[model samples]
Target: MKRKINSFSRKITNNPNLPAAHAMLYATGMRESDFCKAQIGIVSNWYEGNPCNMHLDILGKKIKLSVINQKNLIGFQFTTIGVSDGITMGTPGMRFSLPSRELIADSIETVVEAHHYDGVIAIPGCDKNMPGVMISLLRLNRPSIIVYGGSISSGFYNEKKLDIVSSFEALGEKNTCKISEEEYKNIIKNSCPGPGSCGGMYTANTMASALEAMGMSLPYSSSSPSTSENKKKECKIVSTFIQKLLERKVKPKDIVTKTSIENGVKLAMCLGGSTNLILHFLAIAKSANVHFTLKDFQKISNQVPLIGNLKPSGIFLMEDIHKIGGTPVIIKYLLNQGILSGDCLTVTGETLHENMKKIPNINFNQKIIYPLNNPIKKNGHIRILYGNLSPEGSVAKITGKEGIFFRGEANVFDSEEDANKAILNHKIQTGEVIVIRYVGPIGGPGMPEMLKPTSYIMGSGLGKNVALITDGRFSGGSHGFVVGHITPEAQSGGLIAFVRNGDFIKIDAENNLLTLEVEEEEIQKRKKEWIPPLLKVKKGYLYKYIKTVSPASEGCVTDQF
Candidate 1:
């Protein structure tokens, strides 16, 4: 029989496997006689190949020292894969990016749970890293802390800040010969200067903000630039925060309550954060057993308004948000507006209101974030619509600036590549609703974000006139009159697949609707010939994903129970 540890060291520690554990530690030169006191796992998603996470290696080293030298806890550092969405976009490699979220979550669970670590601190910089670590924390139900790797400062081109989105649009600009090859090369060199996730309110920053609002991270931890000394300070500060959490035995489930989840959505809408958050937030709530649905987002949206003046939807960078405080400015303003829940708890071991007492109210001079009463938009920034085209509903990310209603002839393409080709070849016409289908959770196998195509449309100077609709979702860097996350997706026989070229389609966000203005009998007739496409891969994880992953409406999660 394997021996189990007695309860002398603590209730959950100092196991009976003490003899073998001590022997292995002593052999490894970690010669603390009573070493099995407290173990805190420092999980990291660090890789040299991607700028989004390159800083984490250094961050992790500092945190490990703090954990052992200052806090007197034995810290074990481990790493996992971090696939860069920016590097992989518009290629077969992109298929692996979303799948990597699942792998990272599972890896955290496997490593931490297997060791029975008393607490865990996750430092993740890339897009999937935030939610993946949080999901594992929920499952472990241990004292956990999440520290974001931070955003990169905007690079400069044409005397303006250039980010990843600017670079993507520049490609289209070069394709159209509007910009000379020299200008294109200049943008390529100037758009990204150093380590960090792509700048603007892309997935990396959006989800990082979400994690903070969900109370999984320390306040003001999400908006600082990746390379700043402030980011270094934050890692050390959060290290101490985790020690405090371990003392109180507070946990993820205790903090990620229904109110906190709503708080996350409120920040997402107000910040004009990514639409990918819808799927990610749902997955997290499900993991925590929190009762969150699409209606909850809409209910909160009815109360909150668009305030984040940044990114693909707005005109500032995250570095700007950091200048006049950080994400907490928006969080505090929303909290005081009576639109947010004060009953919620955070990782700080206090109620939401208690924590809000420290953050100063929004500075009127701050243009990046406006006062709640004087929001940039009167309605929710992202509106969910349901109609003939998306019977289960679709997402429309509209700034108050973009017209809420659009009626145009359809320019249908079966895949993202096909639509991308049409746009590059000038086959796409003005006043057309470009329908790209068969790229849902199962169909695309990963439902890659349409930044490539959308950026192309904007670069080609048709952003104001043309619109695109897809069963897949969009990056936070994607804007214009685009509607995505069309449910009962193309592969599942949604009306989006039945859309033929030149067919009339309407996306009306004014009343929340996405409709195919075609005869009912004619739609039924097309449905008879509609067949789910064959799997691109014969086997492996993607094949398993097709069988197990649920719909986008259900958060695109693979695990059922």
Candidate 2:
């Protein structure tokens, strides 16, 4: 049946009126409502001869028919067909089995080549999807625009409005005790109104924000809601921008320079952005053949202060950011301070300095973005530390922290699962360093964020006092004194492999040190018996991921040297 549908689709593609220039490669992880609303035509293209239907499934039940035809389909053969895949997490019963980053990158390459695509607009949200799409665009090196599915409208809970991440944390806490299932469902529904971006400063939203700050997206593109009329307008604008980009022969490399990446890093720090940005930015810089390291982040952090009052750091949403002039304002601030590369070009066909001039009367009032003089926190960059525990250096965010930057006994958990179990059992004590190993690149394989444990630590009200040290990365929304991305991971016999339970660990962000208070002889003795954990994926993408995924310090990106 699928073969039949493919045959029919091929026939349609062969029609000469369906010009290749009009062909827009709209790639997305989910079937967004904005995509459905921006469509023009639809037909029952035979999918495996099973008569698979295609239409807007907004309520997940009724299909809103925009176009229908039975006979004489030959006359309307020139009509465009919008491809919407149900690959996002929001889809019912859909597990997070989307293709790997490299696979998706290759797929986009194939799409651009096979379709002879003149222009492309990517609709990507969520952590993995954004980077996957961005990496693909970078490889394609074509005239492309990323249309982010924006954040959902704020949801109300307990008579107070709450964002997605906070809502989830609240739900997880509420579930621990007694709560009506119906109420939980209501909160879930309220939290997610429609097709949109992820709730927190998780990798998905943070990457979008970084892309915007880096001048890869149109103005206000990062925060527009997926269901808003403005979002539809932005899609049209992106389509138009793609045409312009093609006409001007603007490639991805034109916008993604080293300076542009520096701009992105500065913005990420100011917003107290996701730790995932560290990995994604590193991967992006690698694709561009630009040399960037974790140490560079530490250097940049010393100059840039955390100004954006967003979650995990402060109380604000992306919408508020949009209202306060967005990246343009932030860039202007950095440029004024002689911190940003003013010559960097943006998607708007203007240099970073030139774009700032376009915005009129930008305000830096305390309610919106705080000024550098009165920053929410100073030094927003993720710090890199090295010692006996992480000989090759580990990453940590020290922005907004208010306690002593000192050492504590390591309560090591070999994996996040063990750490979480201990947290749930209340075995974790305050001021003790929580060491989460085996969750690094080769450990979790993809290095899934150790957010669950971090949240549990926060929810237990010990977040202010305790410190989290892990080989894995944290979400952009994650704050506090959390150390991540211990390089030469335990799986590869890095220094983290020598750590034992109750070992004294020291983290001095001020001095850039993350050392285990153990003698060199004792560490050498443990290294002899320290066996690296073996990954057993024999087939599929996970196998490729395990083989190619770099360490957290290297951005955890796959297939790149």
Candidate 3:
């Protein structure tokens, strides 16, 4: 093969004075001629710690082998850390989850930069891993590609499909005596039968689809199941594309432009994606130096229709959508409606329009992805709201079924644990808005997901009756009239800390408002007496995170804080 591209490897390989560098390469089994080839770093977030990433070691090896087969390229595989959000949620362990995103991104960046690899192939399987890897790629500004580890195949129980959320919700059912203890055990046992991210339109699947829409991953990459033969087939094709990317000097920043970011947001809106996207996208935008904001998200949310009939808010699972077709089918629908920008460039070294030209039109016969004209919801379910409560902003995922407007009295708790206990104990009532405070980035010191508490609300049959507002966030599987990512969090001395029980709170998704019905003078008095609580962690990563992490509005990115 003829070489036509410059490589970062040349910095180390071509320097005769760097005998140690050459020695290291030789020690790793590199041949004389191999030194001249482009060095590609295949970064893997593989660990046996969770099902989401358990099989990634096998996938990473396959990717390395594929890269080895590509002439004029030498593949070097490296590992990064990945925290399992599902395993950590609701525990003190959960504080490490959001901070893990930074760790993953920083670790990958450190390895790739230190090694001087010319390009990268990031394989991220979980929520933070996807954005974490993407952020590093954008920061590195190298020829790169992403291959999602893919969604898990849904587990079956009692002739019904189940995923991780099913297990979580089962805990609530057991507490409420909605199901027998044996039945709850059965759901837990079968909820996750094998490897892959959670099989819903949760954060993992949502980020994957959003990345694909933004032209990072290949079409259908987001929707493939982890154990599928198709996923392996897709892995084999990435090495060839990475070579093309390197040859053309196509970097992530070139592909992840403002229009492309908007494309991603538009797709997320239609998919009814996790509220986490707002946090992740803001971080990605900062890394890419794109001028995107939550306001930008609200702009797209206003126009895009919620067409995907999948997941926590809908009747189908990701596997169901995969059966009909994958993310491409959904993209095809959006493209037809002119909601997506076709002119954007993708990792395939072709314009999105060019790529979509090859994708078959949306299969209207499928129920998993609805047509735009007859969407599940007419407007996007991601509502970005601003009011006295969230002076900066807050995010609310409201499927119309939850009702567009909710007005209730305050039910305040300083931590998710307290609120969760209250819900399980049946202390939370109808016509109440549960305010979970001091759990934001600075307060929780890691901004844990409120999945446990939210799932309890649903299991306790109060999903629609009582709304939960928080400074933390919700899992993609979490539904109900819940609002989170409240800015100026309690730790930051936001009015949320001053919220008292019996205070009136109103959430209006239709108008995009989050209002705390307290007089300004009274709120001022409360603020004067309020003292921020001590952080849960005082040392290690959580301590550093609390000191440096930005607010939720800025994606809680630590670098710029």
Candidate 4:
């Protein structure tokens, strides 16, 4: 039964004074009984420039051939770097899409700590390759798993259901002529009909159903699909559960705690998901060192309730919740309504209450996941707002289908291509509140993601009589009455940089408030004639990510300010 060699692959493979690291891992071939096996570092954030990580190099060669057919394991595969925030959403290459989630977690923690790999599988498809490979498997507290390269099937057209946010709302329904140009070129050629990721519940199926309800992938590996055979047999059952998680050395900080990051924010606030899941779950609860904040997502969005109707804010997708019984039947309906925390742990080393006692029951006559006593929103739609234009707080996806009181009238625009060219040139109006403001994260040093100005304010029907505030961030195919991670961010000065154009903004989202109604001596005389705006990339890696990022209320993270 011989299975015990991994102490970082026994100090770089069967020592004997590491003969030049076993002739450089046999010059990329390896054998000598693969130095008595245990290596394992698959990684794969593959490319082809995007169909959300074009079939993740065929699920990284079927999870490196099921982690080298199990027993004592060996696998190596590598590759990282993915950025298509749906192909650089309103370009400058969408400021390298949130700095390619810190360059895919510093190129997978510098190739699993310079090739000492003794556990890590990751795979990941788009939208910051699932929290940049779960923050490089919580900063290499290894024996990791995460398979999720699924989701992509839904494209049709005449039969309707197309995706890639239906070609970013068909370029705002072809610049407001409301479709034609052969129906915006057949909704961008039947809206992404191949590979996967971005088939709603966006932000790559909302960080793959919040890392499979924070056990970090497995259990209907976040609702399958990328041309399913159950997402290639859940990548060979997460490569035979990463050899029982490296023979029980179960890591990733023993399955990401703080109650599984509040069971991944209570399954991304019961699947209404994305305000970029409050900036990729606060950069994966600060790389799972976990002291999570942004008010621990409004205290688990005041007790999770939205209940997955899906899409840019409902009407089903992640392949109709993988035909109504996936995501382990919505984590066994949020663990029989005690709203998740089924004893956490997972990578199939069980407990999420022993994987919800072999999941199954949620058919409740299918309407695509509702049944928490008739919910679509009785609570969590991811709000976290705070007043005085976000005094260190903000993030609103709001899903009570938008009307939680918005007061409007600001219209400003420091850029998301000038508020997507003033909402596709109709000059954004209807009780206005647009205000894109110096694109946060050290002011657009790389914040970028306003999903084409909130899909041109919902293809110009102005989604619910207009509203959009931002310090930059959105595109879980963005929905309206929007708001995004604002903080002391108009390049750190906050008060949304003393907002100005007709100032009157008062979003209350049922009293989580974001008010800006001016007059603290006219906001200190427009913050004494505000000025700070110049360094738009004075050099690379976004001028060292605008000299160290943070402040999207502290999760626009670049090593925490």
lDDT of 2 by residue, 147-230 (tens): 665665667777855655564455446545434667666666676444455444555667877888787878666766556665
Please give me the total number of clashing residue pairs in predicted model 1: 3
| Residue-by-residue lDDT tens digits, candidate 3, 1-561 | 565554688989999999998999999999998988899999889999999999988989999999989887889998899989999988889888899999999999999999999999999998999999999999999999999998988889999999899999999999988999999999999999999999989999999999999999987899888989889998999998999998888999999999999999899889889999999999999999999999999999889889887778887888887888778877876887899989999999998888877777767786777788888899889999999999999999988989999999999998888998899899998999999999999998799987898889888888879999999998888999999999899988998899999999999998899999999999999998987787788789889888888899999998993
Residue pairs with backbone overlap in model 3: none
lDDT of 4 by residue, 1-561 (tens): 455747787777767987988998889898787788888889888889898787898888988988788767888888888888877778888888888888899889998998888888888888788888898788888888888888888778887888887787788778878778898888788888898888888777888888888887788887888778987887876767878878888888888898887887788778888878778778788887778878878878888788788888887888887887778877877788788878878888987888888777787787777777889888898788888888888888879777988897898888888778778888887988888878877778688887887877787778989888888888888898888878877877888877889888899888798898877998888888988878687887888887877776767778873
Best by lDDT: 3
Query: Over 4 Å off in model 3, which ranges?
Result: 1-6
Where is the poorest 10-residue window by lDDT in model 1? 1-10
lDDT for position 508 in model 1: 90
Give per-model TM-scores. Answer: 0.96, 0.80, 0.99, 0.37
Query: Model 1: clashing residue pairs?
Result: 4-16, 5-15, 5-16
- Number of clashing pairs per prediction, in order: 3, 6, 0, 1
What's the lDDT for residue 31 in model 2? 25
Ranking by lDDT: 3, 1, 4, 2
lDDT of each: 0.82, 0.62, 0.90, 0.82
Candidate 3 displacement at residue 380 in angstroms: 0.5
